[model samples]
Target: MNDAGPSSSHPRCDQIAVIGAGAWGTALAAAAARAGRNVRLYARRRQTADEINTTRRNDAYLGPLALPDEITAVTAMDDAVRGADAVLLVVPSSAIRETARDLENCVPRNVPVVICAKGVEPGSGLLLCDVVAEEMPDQTIAVLSGPTFADEVAADMPTSVCIASSPVPGEPVGEGTAAQLALALSAGSFRAYVSDDPVGVEIGGAMKNVIAIACGISRGAGFRSNMTAALITRGLAEMTMLATALGGRAETVAGLSGLGDLTLTCSSEQSRNLRFGLQLGAGTSRQEAFGGAPVIVEGVRNAVSVTDLARKHGLSLPICEAVRAIVHDHADIGTTLGDLWAQPLEFESNAHDTTFRHPDANMARERIEELIG
Candidate 1:
């Protein structure tokens, strides 16, 4: 055992911080505790904290798991975070940076911070890792993401996820943070794979939210599997472009973090984004769907971030842009559909032609400024 730095030699144990009271957080905290560690689950609301501590259940969100005795839920972030060797941030993507900044004052400086969130920032199209690094520069940060559905994972359903960190020389990632987290994350049927690519992991997780929304829309519109498959394919292309732009490994997108999660999330109605899109396909308004939900849907928010970033980077993501239009702009759905479906084909078929001369050079120029800056 060594210091608790990601590559630290400290003897890390089950002292973990779960910074989110949502279903995902509660379920993860349960998973870690069931792995034989003491977990501190943070709840934003005092009543929710009391409920978990008193009843050992988080029925409001994650209805599957009866929290283990070893897991303690608390409202105060400090109480939940204090002296923990590892911390899991399960907050939404839009709130990751802010949440980390707030948690920075409570947790140990050298503790490993693992981001369990999966989406990009709207104000700044930065990945979750970047957001974590911006706040906790010296802290060892990693990303844990995949196609995890809270209820399924809570019920000990078979699930696979990536636990990734940045590569460091002489860093023996064996039987340390990776092992501890793997143990915490693994259970009856869950399997965890370790990677040294933080950029790729976070990018895959975030970008997939955007893609899943399109997949949902395709399904919602009663489109056949043919269109759904095409959307997924094109969605992957968009994800690859965004990930590459953010310096993530290209191959990672095709791995569990990208292709795997995208497949699960986009196909299932259980996914919040997909469900929201289903409502859209059923002719419901975005405001109406958002208004009915008590929890935050990361994909809907991600639509704004992805579209804005693509515009800034001048990357063309017609699907995401269309989602934004329907969600935000008062654009007519039929006209919007026509605009997107009828987009003129470029003479060049190669997706790698990053610098294609668009018919609208001025618009492209603005988009480039939006993405590159």
Candidate 2:
């Protein structure tokens, strides 16, 4: 019942519940609190909740960064979601289904649930949004994704993300709008743009992690910016292709969630996926590469999932496949990269052309540009 009406131009619900105590979740809670909204952050452990509440920090995740006073940490699930105007699920991709199921009992039926985790379900290969819909059929769902680093956003750095959600079914006049969801999450330094292409946003967010690993490997293997550029461009093509086949717009990949995120994650030392790939390139064992790491490098898991999803569509995602082979199959990084580069090349098409873009995206970038610009 907290759903925002479609006609509201500056739609934003005030009370927000964020599920998960990880770095990203804490960062978002801080952003909301900075926006002067009542925000509740859920942590599974009472100690974690206590630390965040009493110390105004998440020691394990944010590492002593002060949280805004308006943010409250909650240990009880019901207490977190009760009377919330919006809900953000920021857990890892593997936990999406379980988390959504738990929320079915607590979340109001119409409160928009924004998914911040990125990846495809391993065995089923379903996108996280689809998985959530299956678990919480009565709830409205949206996805938030872009070139975000948790610490940067928490520090109030200027950042932008795309929000994609379907309008409430069959409610022609008063649907739960994605713009409303975006407005609710946006703050002074944090901006949100609404989109209809959840598939594109989700795929872009998931695949970039895999590509960041590849970029890290190239850098660690003594390659320069030339190789990184090549890999990034080709990787975008692969991502655009796969996203298009799976009912997403190709131009969406060129937007913040795809191109923007790809550039940021691949080049930054702060990225866990890139760091993990650096270890792989330096000849470390998988266990040693991620040993005692606090954050989850999504690429390690997404590599396998992306490869499988590509194969299902009879497509060749060379970079993703190589990352998987190196990370999972123990294949030699040199041999994998060599083979990937040895493949025959094709002419580069304009990214906006119909031949290159997804068929489902009948709308133009001009429309989206108008919205954001």
Candidate 3:
């Protein structure tokens, strides 16, 4: 295979540095390469890099799919970030802080780092961007999330994700780094829609994994379709409330990262969280469920974080609470499902609806700045 850059028919795109060699990272690298952008995939292990470079395949993460000729895998962090137009951080949520910290002095100044991983930090309840900001204060950040399975994306299946960046509040995106990177990354059968609500996008992506577990437990425990639908609707309300309290727009949650991802993850057994929950519902121990699995099931970890985030905001999230009980507290899945329904009925709509009375924009902005600082 040839190692040429993107074809000249398209404008010269950025050399995208994808930091992570997991299934999602490899798939995005392949997509960027397919879109005629120069791509570099960074792996922590030299063997992983050698495997991709020598065989043109990331069989460990993505199976037998052939990577694009325009892509190269490197083990060195400097080789990945140096001279790159954009960086895609596709590591798991737990490693995002440390992974980005390594880029502090190496990343090109002003180059945007796109967060491809989804989840809130465990103890701090900070969104991925907030965590990144704390570590790499000068780096520009964007979020890429939605209802995508890595294998499907690698197969060139039709997939759409929301790309969110911190925009000046109330300003329409024109030439922002997020939009530009979105344009470059949109390839055959994969589309990206830009948004300024990184908060909502990140929250939705993180919370949906927890909700997927709830949905799987419902299914494995023999709940009806109406129960599943109820879980989804109520779950969205819970998600919307927490997001709104955190200064994100509710409509953003209704978009690809929110309803779109929730629907896909909850309904599909392909979801790792869902599968884990299914095993739990069938009476398997947590260790047994994950003992032989190759991938990290994010929802199991996100359950604690989501619960903590909701509590931090003084919000009531029954679905998230139940998931936390099941996963962390070792509550019986059946009893937890019962507890969810037994709770006293209240107004379905949230008190601080992002759709209606908005929070003080100035205060929100100031708070965000302080957190980043």
Candidate 4:
């Protein structure tokens, strides 16, 4: 891949503030720096900031990979976003609301705040983008998601991601903000595709983690590739249903943020969600599956939120429900697996059905009506 520098056609974002110094955040900082943008990486801990500034490495999250000199580590949130043209909130999904709330007073209203985390909010069942919007109402919100691995991206390996921007209700859409941000981050090895479907992009990013756990459980339980393939296909259908119900385009679900991310997360052991599922399927307790460290397995938490969101739309996401049962409800894996296998057969596609077929059909009908109206 040719390292195409920032495009001259779009508005240039010369400085990017990446909130969080975890693997993904550090990797994004590297990518932005590689694209010739100065990067300020915000770390919660002074020690982390000092380590990265002193060594140009975030060994805690990114091993020995040396970051570009254009990247600087900052401990103060205000300092990080002070002059940043764009802010990439790469913190965990659970931290998004709080982080955005903190940034409300810091990030300039004109600067775009891109959400880089996945997973629905556990209690509100709100997408992370929505969570950010609620906190930073004046900021242009976008989402970046796809089949990306932090290690590979940090190493300058070829990667493609979708960056989607959508206007908040009652606000004018930023016609070229996604494209401009894409231009800022684009490189020979790092490609960014722009879209207007933050809803679809975020849905894909969040739900894929839940589906990955299901895939991991299936694989760990000795199911063949056939089972994994079935789960992935059906899981995607569920994703499309929820996304469209929430006003996202179906085509977006087929793009890099949706199917692309789903495939990568489900197939790779590098995904913490998949690894957690594997441990669960291999008879490890949920608490033990965490391996006693402060690792965030997004799917485990998202299972609850995804299922909740699906219920809100009156959609049936069987695989996600199964994961929720096993992970949260502590239902026996054997029983859950049996329950899944025993479900009655139905038409594979509901394209012709005017109404969704579910126990909460009325709710689904009303929600769809609200969305369309």
Which numbered prediction scores highest in TM-score against the true structure?
4
The 10-residue segment of model 3 with minimum total lDDT is 3-12
For candidate 3, report its TM-score: 0.89
Q: Global CA lDDT of candidate 4, please?
A: 0.87
Off by over 4 Å in 2: 1-12, 167-176, 290-295, 350-373
Query: Which pairs in model 3 have colliding backbones?
Result: none
Measured by lDDT, the strongest candidate is 4
Residues 223-333 of candidate 2: C-alpha lDDT, one tens digit per residue: 678889988998898889899999999989999999999999998999988888787777677788767555578898999998899999998788899899988998877
How much is the lDDT of residue 186 in candidate 3? 90
Better lDDT candidate (3, 4): 4
> How many backbone overlaps does candidate 4 show?
2
RMSD of each: 6.5, 9.1, 10.0, 7.7
Instruction: Kindly list the per-residue Cα lDDT of model 3 for residues 47-111, writing each as its tens digit.
Output: 99999999998887888988888889999999998888889999999999999899998986578
lDDT of 1 by residue, 23-52 (tens): 888878877877777899998898888988
Looking at model 3, residue 367 earns an lDDT score of 41
TM-score each candidate.
Answer: 0.86, 0.88, 0.89, 0.90
**Count of clashing residue pairs in every prediction:** 11, 0, 0, 2
lDDT of 4 by residue, 252-359 (tens): 999999999999999989999899888888778888876777678998889999999889888888999999998999987766776665555567785754433355
* Full ranking by TM-score: 4, 3, 2, 1
CA RMSD (A), model 4: 7.7
Clashing pairs in 2: none
